[model samples]
Target: MNEMNETGAHCHGDAAARVAEISGLFVSIRQILAQMIDGIGVPDARTPKTIIAKLSELQSAHLKVLAAEEAFHAQQDAVGGADTIDMETIRADIRGQLDRIRAAQDAGPLSGGAE
Candidate 1:
């Protein structure tokens, strides 16, 4: 990694972290939905009201996820002008691309450009 670009490496790490956060949030949202579904019938007094609260929480969670995704995209866009930028990074496939880029760099320039 000493040869790889710092910002590019950070971009990949940040994207992966943000994506994992979003995925965890989605998991929570799914659990809430499942709870809501489970409480469909039954004479429990936690019906409609509980469902409404869960829905509101779910909405908030989704909004947070969206914001995280937007921020992640903005970070990637900021890195777009860098020489280290590659098609994989552009396509949001950071892991694969960065790994390949590091490998390429280690192997020396394949052609003329600084891959």
Candidate 2:
């Protein structure tokens, strides 16, 4: 039996589950983008900068998904695979992403925008 890691996440022999978790994140990202496009709640609420900011977050999510997939693959213990994952690079990306998100939120919503 595999013991759960300190984060309560399954370790070893759980590649499939980890992949499924990544898939779920992708689904959420799609839903968020759709909502932003449809503007279902507020008419003309999305500002130009707001859209850009959201895209920044999208990029952040993209990097995370890429890293997750890389980690998932490496966990498989395959004979041949891509280079090992770099924890430092991933951490740096997330820090930058957080800054972008905060700046985006600072831009706030607009009273008038594309409807």
Candidate 3:
């Protein structure tokens, strides 16, 4: 887990928006793992350590993508660009990742390894 420094009191409007963002993050994570599992579909069903490492790397990248999105949103808000937030574009990008994850899942277990 990454460390977040909490200094000033945090402020946010619209509880629903916060909830939505959190929900999206979790859904994205789930989708990512599911895709990994699918791509690495177990004839043996147990992910070996190396495969697990790859999954962790993928998760880290996914989190970075989410954090970057949040940072972009914050920056836009700070600069009065909130109205220009291209939610559709963001969603589309996420959808693309999800699709890739699914394809990877379909690729079956990692090759050249004893799980």
Best by lDDT: 1
TM-score for each candidate, following the candidate numbering: 0.35, 0.31, 0.35
Model 2, residue 109: what's the lDDT? Answer: 91
lDDT of 3 by residue, 62-92 (tens): 7776787678568546766334556568768
Give lDDT per model, in order: 0.66, 0.61, 0.66
- Residue pairs with colliding backbones in model 1 are none
Candidate 3 stretches with Cα past 4 Å from truth are 1-38, 41-45, 82-115
Superior candidate under TM-score, 1 versus 2: 1
Give the Å error, residue 46, model 1. Answer: 15
Ranking by lDDT: 1, 3, 2
Compose the digit string of candidate 1's lDDT tens values, residues 1-115. Answer: 4445566678878876876786777677667755664555343465578666766765676677667767866876676643465745555677778889899889975668765
User: TM-score of predicted model 1?
Assistant: 0.35
